[model samples]
Structure formats: C-alpha cells, structure tokens
Target: MPELTGWAWALLALAAVVVGLSKTAVPGAGTIAVAIFAAVLPARQSTGVLLLLLILADLFAVAMYRRHADWKALVRLAPAVVVGVLLGVVFLWFADDVWVKRTIGVILLGVIAITLLRRRLQAGAGADTGSHRIAAATYGSLGGFTTMVANAAGPVMSMYFLAARFEVKAFLGTAAWFFAIVNVFKVPFSIGLGIITVPGLLIDLVLAPLVIVAAFFGRWLADRMPQQLFEKLVIVFTIVGAVYLLVS
Candidate 1:
C-alpha cells in the first residue's frame, strides 16, 4: 500500500463512506468522493482505486434496490455508453494528468448546465421528454466518458433519470445496476492501462467495510427522504463537486 499520511487516510475513509451513500442515497454525491480521492492520490491512480470502491458500494446498492430497475432505460443506454467508454480509453491513452483533470471538470460543469436547462424545459412543458432516443444517447455517452475518465458518472446519470421522471426507488435501482455493470466492465481497461494495481487493491481492502456500512445507512436515509429534497440535494452536491474539481 502507498505510505499515506494520517490525514490522507482519514480523507480516503470519508471518501469511501461518501461512495456508499452516493450509491444508495444521493447519486451525485459521489462526485465529492471523486474530488477527495483525486486530491489525495495521483489523478489516474485515484480513478482506478475509486473504481474498485465504487463497485463494492454498487453491490450493496444492487442488493437493496435490485427489483426497481427500468430495463428499457438500461437497454437504450448500453450501446451509447460503450462507445463513450471506448472514447475515454483513447483519451487516456495520450492525455496527461493535467488534461484528464481539466477535462473532467469541464464535463461536470457542462453536464450540470444541461441538466438544469432540461429541468426548466420539462417544468414549462409539464412533462419530461427524456425518453427520446437522442436524449438517452447523449446522456449515456457522456456518462460513459466521464465515468471512465474520472469515475464521475454519478451526476450525469442522476440528471438523466431525473429528467426521465423516475421515482426515487426506480432511479436508485436503475443507477445501481447501471453502474454495477459499467464499473465491472471498466476493470479490465483500467488494469490494462496499469491504473488498477496491487497497492490500490490493498487500500480498498481496508476501506471496503466502511463502504458496506455506509450503504445501509444511505438506504435507511433514502427511504425517509422526500422526493423534492432528494432532487435538490443531488443538484446541490453536483454543483459543489463541479466547482471543487475546477478550482482544486
């Protein structure tokens, strides 16, 4: 394992708990974990390390919300997401750490803008139009790219599900399974790129239990949270995360 300082370890522990909560309670909150991990580790290495922790959280999310997923949404997103992942791999092939960090920051801000605009439009129209194929492709592709590059897909997909007008349970369920599969698919690519390493896995082993505990806590919290409060929290956290990425 890397010889992290006490403060670094503490931050990573917090990040792990945030990952669990994000998986089960507030989706966009995971971006905060991304920011924390990136601050403490090498940018690329952080992505690999975070991916493993995220998958662990995803498992708990799946266990809790497995039956609520929308298969139609998942099916529509698969192809576009795959394409986006391939593009992200290509970007990683040549971009340096600075580029990767800046690109992710930019993407986060852009996604937030688009999401906000879509919400306004939906309000005016009195309905969500996110069921269209083009909307799905756009969000899916962006979700894939951001997740591959920075493990920052939580906000992007959260926006999509919100725009699609999913109820709280359905949103969490779909996101849980979507990321569970997507994160698993990313493992080999990360390994091939020399991103996921033994030391990172060692770190994950120490933090895994925290993630599991937080997942259950998140599930309990989500069950009681009002839908309006939940959506507001997602947007708020996403904006905070985007700003942190840009300035940090």
Candidate 2:
C-alpha cells in the first residue's frame, strides 16, 4: 500500500481534524491538511489525496449545515473559480513536486499576513469595495487556483466571508456547501491527473472515517460558540497556520 509511516499516519489524523474544524468552526485553518500531506506524500500526490479528504470533510460539513449556506454568494463565485481552476491546471503542467511544496507554503504565508492586516484594518477602519461581483470574481479565482494546486481553497473564500461580516453559522454553512461542491468536482480532475492511485485510495479508506467523526465534533463546538468568539478564534488560528507553513 502507498501508506504513510506510523508518524505520518498520526500527522494525517491530526490534519483530518483540522479539515473538520475548518469547515465547522474556523473556515480557514486547513493549511494543516496541506502541511501533513506534503510532509508525508510526494508534493503532487498530496494535493490529490488531500482533495479527496477535503471532499469527504466537505460532505460532512454540508450535511451538518446545508441550511446555513448563502446560495447567492456561491453562485456569484463559481464562474471566476472555474477560470482559476483552468489556470491552476496549466501551472501544474510546469511545476514539479518540490516547487508545489514551496508554492503552497509561500501562498499560505501571504494569506496569513493578509488576513491579519484585514483584521487590524477592520478594527480601526475597513476597506472600501465597489461590488459583490468584484469580490466574488477575485476570491473565486484565488480559491480555484489554490485548491487546484495545493488544496488551499479554505483561506481564500474565508477572507471574503469574513469581510462580508457573516455571522458565524452562516460563514461556516456557506463554506461547508461551497467546499463540498468544489471538492466533489475535483475528483475527475485528480483522477485524470493520476494523483489518486490504488495505494493512495487504500490509505484514504483508513483515514476517511476519522474525517466524519471530527466533523461531528466540530459541528457541536461551532453550534455552541457565540459568533464573535468563533470568528476571533478563526483569525487567531489562521495566523498560527500561516506561521506553521512559513517555518515548515
């Protein structure tokens, strides 16, 4: 089997928890998922397998929060995201395994910095923006590109939702449905790219059930937290995730 070592399995399990938590509570801390996979698997292969895990997590999230999603935002973001996916596929052709790892790290750090800056600005002031269409187009492209290349979609869309001032549940619910839909669509692309192999699938079989469990736990916690605190915690963890990537 194309299995990770014992330590790698442990890391993967922990990373799976991050995936669940991201969907249910944080909406952006999924670089842990990318980090664990890239650390254990070939960089390119990690992207494929992580995409599968993300889809599984996404399914659980959608099931738990289908009622909380904002369909208008989802529809607004889809077209630009599709274009970004194509761009990512093009980049994949040129990038090797190591470059993918470096690229993912760099992007994560940038996202972290931007998120912090956004938070600071919002605390003192706020950025002026023209229209929802503009934000949707920009975020959609970034989400599609990052998710395709590195399974890093969570942060991109997350920033948008945060800026939009969504209540906690709405943010998570919308993110849940959004990622679930995107992840499901990623399957054919991952297979066509030869990222998901027999051994990889076997490994995933072992890890997948844990995703379900964590999502349930995350849902319970998210339900309990007040909106203000949940978003604050999300920002804090996003900073932590960024730093982890930068140092790793």
Candidate 3:
C-alpha cells in the first residue's frame, strides 16, 4: 500500500463505512464513497480499487438481504444492465473522467428531478400502473452505465424503487442483490482495465473491517427506525449525494 497521509486514511475509513451501509442498509449512500475514491485516488486506479471494495460490500449485502430479493425485477433489468456494462467499458476507454463525472452527475440530478416531478404528478400512488416497463429500461441503462463508469449506482436504482413505491425492505433487498450480482461480474473487466493492483488490494484489507461493522450497524439502525422515516431519510441523502456529485 502507498503510505497514505493520516487524513487520507481517515477518508478511506469513512468511505468504507459508506460502502457497507449503502450495500447492506441505505441504498443511496455509496455515492459519497464514489466521490471519495475519485477525489483521493488517481483517475484510473480509483474505479479498480473501489470495485474490489464494492464487491466486498456486495457480499455483506447479499448475506443480509439475500432472501428478500425481487427476482422478477432482477430479470427485468438484467439484460439492459448487461448491455449497459458493455457500453460503460467502452465509455471508459474513450471518455476522460471529466465527461464521465459530468455524465453521471447529470443522470443523478435528472433522476432526482424525475422523482420529485413524479411525486407531484401522482400524489398518492400505492403502486405503478404497469407503465413501468419503459421506466425499468431507462433506469437500468442509466444505472448500469453510471455504476460501471463511476460506481454511482445508488441514485439511478433508487429512482426506480421510489417510483414503484416499493416497501422499504423490498427496495433495499432488491438493491442488494442487484449490485451484488453486477459488481461481481465487473471484477474481470476491472482487472483487465488494470484497476486493481496488489497494493490497492492491500489497502482494501484495512478498510474491509470497517465495511463489516457498518453493515451490521446499518441493519441495527434500519430495524429500529419507523418505515416512513427511513424512506424520508433515504430521499434526503439521495438529494444530498446527487448534489454533491454534481458540485464536486
């Protein structure tokens, strides 16, 4: 591992907690860690290093929320997201992170805008009106592309669940499985792209423990909060994370 300054070390620990909590508990918080990686590491190595960390987080998310997945939704978004992953790889090759960051920021803000508009349009939606096939396709493509390029998956996917009015557990569970499967698939590609190095992996070893603790803590917190409050908290963080990405 490179000899990180103490401040960078603290940032890494904070990022680790964000990753675990996002995967296992809050569905939209990983954007902060994505920002952390982009800010702390080199432009190229950040994704590779963060990819490994994300996979670790995915494991914990799967273990905690495995039984509660929405398989049908997974099936619905799988093909599109796979296509997105492919496009993302190509995008990475051609686009500098200036474009990538701007692109994802636009996407995040767009989703948040859409979510707010949707709520205004349908003030009391208990469920979608089966008009969500196109919605699924849109979010899937954006989610896959943003995630692959920037590890910014949370907001894109969160928009989908929010619009569909998923109950809290269902939203979190589906998100857990979705990212777990997709992030694992990204491993070889990340390796091929020369993102993960032995040194970076070593750094991951130190941060991994924080991830585990945060996952458990997130679960504890989630179980204790009222459902409405949890949903509202998610919305607030999503807005914050999205805005931060746009600004940073």
The candidate maximizing TM-score is: 1
Model 3: number of backbone collisions: 0
RMSD of each: 1.5, 2.5, 1.6
Residue pairs with clashing backbones, model 3: none
Off by over 4 Å in 1: 124-131
Q: 195-230, model 2: which lDDT tens digit per residue?
A: 877777777788888888888889888878987787
Order the candidates by TM-score, highest first.
Answer: 1, 3, 2
What lDDT does each candidate get?
0.90, 0.78, 0.82
TM-score for each candidate, following the candidate numbering: 0.95, 0.88, 0.94
lDDT of 1 by residue, 18-76 (tens): 99999999999999999899899988788889999999999999999999999999999
lDDT of 3 by residue, 1-248 (tens): 68888998899899999988887667788888988877888867778778888888888777877888889888888988998888999998899878888788888888888877877787865446355677778889888898888888887898788777777778888888898888888888888888778888888889889988998888777677777776776777777777776677
- Looking at model 2, report the run of 10 residues with the lowest lDDT sum: 122-131
Model 3, residue 159: C-alpha shift (Å):
1.5
